[model samples]
Target: SASETPGKAAVGEENIVKLQHVQDTREFFIEVLEYLPGGNLYQYLEQKEMLDEYTACRVSLRILKALDHLHARRLLHRDVRLQQFILAEPGDPESCKLADLWCLASLPRKKNFMVEEGRPCDLLTAAPEVVKQGEFSAKSDVWAAGCVIFELLHGHPPFGGTGKALVQRICCGEPEFSELGTATGGLSDNAIDLLRWMLQREPGQRPSVHECLKHAWFEGYNVEKPSKQVWQVEKLIRHVKLWGKPPHSRRNLPASNLLASKRGIVTPGFCTYMGATSVDIDFEPCQMCQGVLEVIGKSEEQQSLGSRVWYWVTKCVLSLWGREENPKQIQLKVCVKPGSPWVELGSCTLDDSTALEASIKIDKPIRYVRISLRGNLGGHFGIAVRKVAFYGYQVRQIPIALHLENLKFLRGSRLHTHAQDIHPKEVNARVHKSLQSSLRVGRRIEGTGAKYRVYEDICSGSPHITTAAETPRLKFPQGVVLIGAVLGLRYVSEVPSKESAPPRLRIQIVKEVNAGGDHERRMKKTLLFATEDLTPPSWKANEVLGNGYVDYPVMFSTGIRANGDDRLHLEILFQNFSGTAHVPADLGLSFFYVPELQSPSTSEDEGLWAGCIQSVQSATVESVSLGMRKLLSIWFPFHFPRSFPCDFLLLRFYILQPYILVSLT
Candidate 1:
């Protein structure tokens, strides 16, 4: 009201008169009004030390009757406050009338746009919808009436603070009268109960103004006209000035003095919200120093504004290391920007409204952050933000590593063949037989000296020197030497050397002559030679004399005759041979030998008869050593008639020489 006329202005004058303009609908005050003047109730409340219970009830009843009449006429007073009430006469306790028609809007005017542009109405006396959604109805006015009653009893507005804070408190919930202490004393129980019901969450739940008038708190109160007397406005103004402004102004002045004047300490911070009745704050563990700071709000409950809540903190940081300079305190202020998406989770704001925060520990430090909404905001509409900062320490980084292992080598022999004798005794006997018989018969065998012979004619060249009647009766030497080992060797013997009287032995490899004719025969008359030593002493025979003469005649035989008692060592080697193109189905070793037997007749009467024959002893030698080339042949179940190279050598006395081999069949 002071700002409307323009003067030095009260502390909150600019905020009190901000108005909105709409389509004009003028009504003559004198024609519609029934009462004269009561002056402003807000100013009257300030001047009076206190109102008695009976007086407060009487005043509340008049306001209710007026509102009931307005509701019946379908007129809504969108703006109602202590300032709108006037006195009918000076010093008249019960004469009051509602004023300020500027904020009124018609019921049939579908859009009540006038209310938005009227005066900067007191939020403490406004309804929840007016603060939250800017919607107003007759029920909203009832809520305003409840606030006026609270103010009348308390000597101040029900929830008073920054206009924003009061709005937030009203939207959230009504302020408790019990928190007003002595200011709320002497109020009738029915009066307090009706006030609370008017502030119910749903507008439809609130009682009509006519129903409020019938409340028990107004039992003895009358709505009839009282005496009208002209009141002097200057005298009332003097009375109001003597009582001073609202208690909030007086209480806040001392705090303002301390903050404005204190040099060394950082001043405590404050915040305001749109629809809240209180501004709750916690300043314990002061943001700046170790000392605690005090917090004040519009209501003792510390209500906050329902829109655009503000947060503030004070702190000091040492900028230099060694300089003893005055502590520099700075104020950090942040507004809770309100929106649906930013509902309060938790915050340092003591009222626990828009200021939201939950205990969150970022395990790792981060930078350049952008936070998006994660959950609901407790059924409210807009988002709100105040301030955020990390307090204690700095952040850091870390590192990593790895390892491995290695590799290594593996171990294995190649394949070979060595000669193993299958029938040594038979082989020795065979050698002796061939040597002795070949010496006695002196015939040429087909395989004895020939390099190669046709398959069918193997035994053809052998001397048919003796039939069964002319078979050899020979005396063999006691020992024989085999100089070379050869596969297919069958028989051998020792005989006298022509060069001297001592016996000479010859070692021989022999195969039996098969009886079948050309078509059935498979043997070839070829002796495979492993060596070329044809000298005489190299040929030798086994020591068994009877075994040497037992078989049919040996084809070739030779021996060595040296000094007395001189021994000779014989070495022999054998290998199997076959044509490369024809791999025989079966191959084996054969040994030819002779056996000694008694004469068939009694000796004295008939000439002594020596009957002899060649016999074969089974021999199988898998490994054999050829002269220079190693060849392996199978020699197990059956004998394979094949030729291979042969050699013989005699070692006697101090001399070592190649033993001559005499060819035999």
Candidate 2:
């Protein structure tokens, strides 16, 4: 029968099982086919769990050929999965044959092909269109094949869930490909690109079986194992072992571009490594990017995607002491996440003679790393680590200070120098008018209505004509936390325009509370600093206002949360002292949005999130401004909660060499 089939020569016959004999009986018809001793690929995967990049590529290449053969005859193997493929030989994995063809269907002449409603099939391998609109075509088979290939590498299907939610995700979701393998069994961009093409939601956009075969993922790809596998961390570290004498000095180091090479352990700065008994290294939270799944419903029990999963460590470089009489063995272990088991990353020998630089290439990504030293007795040297580096998937955080021009408060008209023209009564009247207009148009401002009007006019054109300066805005990838800030300023005694006036600095915290639809309320807290400190008898007038630094304590008992629905704003105003503490004329004003603060779920989570054992640190310092003369710098340290969805936070702005630094501990 195989010999009689037409176009059998064109389509590789070896990829398919040969139909041998058939018998006809009165009650039933029996057929016989070639037998292969090896079991199906699904069984092989069950035994091996997962395949390396080379083996996976080899198996995928043959599966594509089998699919190509079937598609050439305009036939659809509706069920395309690992279970449908049988291995031709026991030991050889690449020798796969397409077996079950009972679900095969001929290609329809119509452009649109629809399957029966509620038909039971492989849900995991089913395409989006098939699950949504019941549309089935040859491209649907390609989608199924891609899923098989994905499972082969990652050891699981691209999408996981059950019931209606799984169906919804299949219909409207993209696969998570943050984890994929390359030619060396590491992350491969080419593989991800190919998968994107094969798994396109629109069937027409997907490449044909032939086009998939021609993709660059298959180029220069062979079944032969790599001469030196880069994914084997043990093999990479084993080569640097030397039982003899050390080199002259610590001159021969590994490549400088490694993860921990020049960059310090916590951040990109200098680090001093001391020889200690035991040491644990964790990456800085600010260096990583994070994402959370969109909550589908407001209910507490509603299921939504959690924060993104990360296994940042892939390759590592360790610089250790090279020469010693009794060398100590180091044990390397990695933890995938908190509470997860620590996997052994293999041990290596180290000495204190010459500088030893060992590059360990890991096949898997790890989150936390723990290193222990063995063979160290009382009075013997412990693990002497010079520098350690890592290489893997990283989403760097944006420095808030570097992009200060983008802040909302920094963008607007120049400082208002004509404070002398408007009387206090006239200013109050204008403030009242602006407040009435904002209420009518559904705008909310905490204090100083005129300043709010100016900000509103610049951001969104309003009827109120106000001057606002233009400054750059920092675009965040996702919602970020505001931890803290620091400010620096220069004060002057008397203003050039106003003869007897003295300058003052005012800081305000404004929180906008939203009560459901339409209705909203504003809460304000203000702190003022004056430069009326008595000058020393020997000091001159100019010397008193020349240079000074003051520490201002900002205390709030309750937490503040800022989000799209509700917001918290920090505003700073420079004004001339009006003799009394009641009112001060505004000279210039600037404000920006601060991060939302939420309480932790548990006490243990609070400790982890706070990054310190102390619950609170408090210090009181009196505020004294040297009469603002142009210099202004801010540095605020905002508290970041570990349980929150924020990946990184930044506080940055500049004015006349003034800069703000936001530090997260």
Candidate 3:
């Protein structure tokens, strides 16, 4: 090729040219290539001030096409910014080619890669979910491309601020051409529509690169009308409804939080009205936090734990928006029912300067939690909470039928006033405090016909499973002996919060049955058996606790039942060795039943397993708070495919927290 070119010419496997090392034989060398004299998009934009609308459109359209090509090859150009846009040919803006593959990533990457594949830690024109959870895919590239297009049309980036303001603006605000004086700026409605679709806060809602190319904005004269304008309008209405609304404070998930039909539409941001209300002032934009409960007020108005039993609120989170006029002092309390010698569990105070927090933790389960606020020198107004979340379990849900019941309370875990009796009535008069609830938190909660999801088994370290002796002929990955079908169960906390997370603890898995005769029936039936110690013993004393949540995995023997009773009475009993931790009331567990493999049949070649989902039926989910942890188990009759290998099931894990418990500290 060119004799003066700086970059090397490949020589196949022996493709070594004299790599130009930095001066004086330093180890690092640079790959020199023929200099691109045309200059990049940033330089062009600086010289021209702003690109013409058609030229801008053409550039964006070309970039999208190039991106589509990369994405089709399962690659992601994550940093699709101005610097990367190079002239495909000198002096031709229409032929711009994207450059600077700093953050380029291969598609469908691992979820926890953190800083691999050019995923920048800084928020440099990325999607909301990317900023929120380091999640990226082809759609994420589309978002950055949209941002570049926006910057081209206007003279600057759409949401230009520093620090938290920049993140919030990018995540929550809708930039409009109307804001840029659309009449004179002259961006077509189709163009605006395409940009808006690409920049949607929710990644699931955004269009694919192919879909973007098909949008009316790119069609020139063949602009296509959107198929469902009503759907778009409804989405906009939902967004509007979520904002600027008065806080019902202390209200359950009200009508506004849910879509009317049973469709599986999960909207973005916090619509669920959980937590306490701040002062009731009429404001233009809803002071509502995006994904948490609002808990700001002058006087005491704690959340009630419902009219039923005791729930251990393991964690509580308080996300600050900003204080109103009077927010100098903050007092938080967790106490039992009101009486003399008031049974107080814990109390903490927050000053204005050092008050910012993502979560606040408590050791015990208490019915009442009271928050009070006072203002500082300059102003006097109520405390204004942006978001508040909690985690805990009800006392009655523990099912301490006989041996597990505690007649005497531990001194430190004594949020309960009944120091001697476990019955609520004996101490109900003294323990009538406030907690979240015993009712369903979300409508799509189990027993509502929502499809169950298969979650990966979660355990600290590399804990292995041991099955009871039954089908000793069968085996599984990780030395798991086949008993019946091992139920892959994962716990879900409703109001999952960092502070709300209980300390490290063990959970006992047991199956109960009606063993006693009809009239003379006893309480519990031991239909389930464990092959070894209940909790995995390999957990180290100095185990690294997560930012908040931990997964306690349990495996049960599923072989004994012969009556075709698909449902098993699986009971989760939390071990109280660590008094500092309490199971959140919002505890949820899901199970996917996998049948045990049978020994080969009449034919020698007949196998024990298959690849299909035919053997496994519907997965079951039980919410601890709603008391349906046992009876409402799901068991669809789907079976594993008739013929396939049994050992191919690869276990994977997923973390899905409820809407109300997002941490913003």
RMSD of 2: 23.4
Q: Name the lDDT of candidate 3.
A: 0.37
Q: Which of the predicted structures, 1 or 2, would earn the higher TM-score when compared with the native?
A: 2
Stretches of model 3 off by over 4 angstroms after superposition: 1-34, 88-91, 108-124, 181-184, 221-665
lDDT of each: 0.32, 0.43, 0.37
Model 3 Cα lDDT, one tens digit per residue, 1-665 = 22212122121111111223212235533343233567788778766545545667777777887777666656666667777776746777776665543344554445412334344544647777778777767778888888888877654666655677778877887663432333323456777777888888877888889999898766672322222110100000001122224444334333233221111122221221232223321111111112111112211211111112222344454455443332444444532112111223334455554354534454343334444433432333223454343433222111111111111111111011101222333222332121111111223434554432211111111111211111101111221122232222212222223343332222233323455676553334344422221222233221211111223332323343222232223332333222322222112211112222111000011121222112222222211122222111111001111100111111112111211111000
Instruction: Give the TM-scores of the predictions, in the order they appear.
Output: 0.30, 0.36, 0.30
Report the C-alpha lDDT of model 2 over 316-388, residue by residue, as the tens digit: 6665545341225656665322322345666666544464665555533333455444453222333344545
* TM-score of model number 1: 0.30
C-alpha RMSD for every candidate: 54.1, 23.4, 25.6
lDDT: worst 10-residue window of model 3 = 230-239
> For candidate 1, lDDT tens digit of each residue in 1-665?
31122111111211122223223234422213334555677667666633555677788877777676667666677767777777767655467766655555556556423335344555767777777667778888998988887766655555555545555666674565642232223344666777778778678898889888778777753334233221111100001011111112222222122111111122222112232222222111111211111122222211111011111111111111111111111222111111101112122212233333322222111111112222123323212222222221110000000000000001011112111221333334443332322122112445454222111000111111110110111112222112111122222322234442221123222222445775553422223223221222233332222232111111211121211112221112211111011001111111111111111100011111111111212221212112211111111111111111110111110001112111112
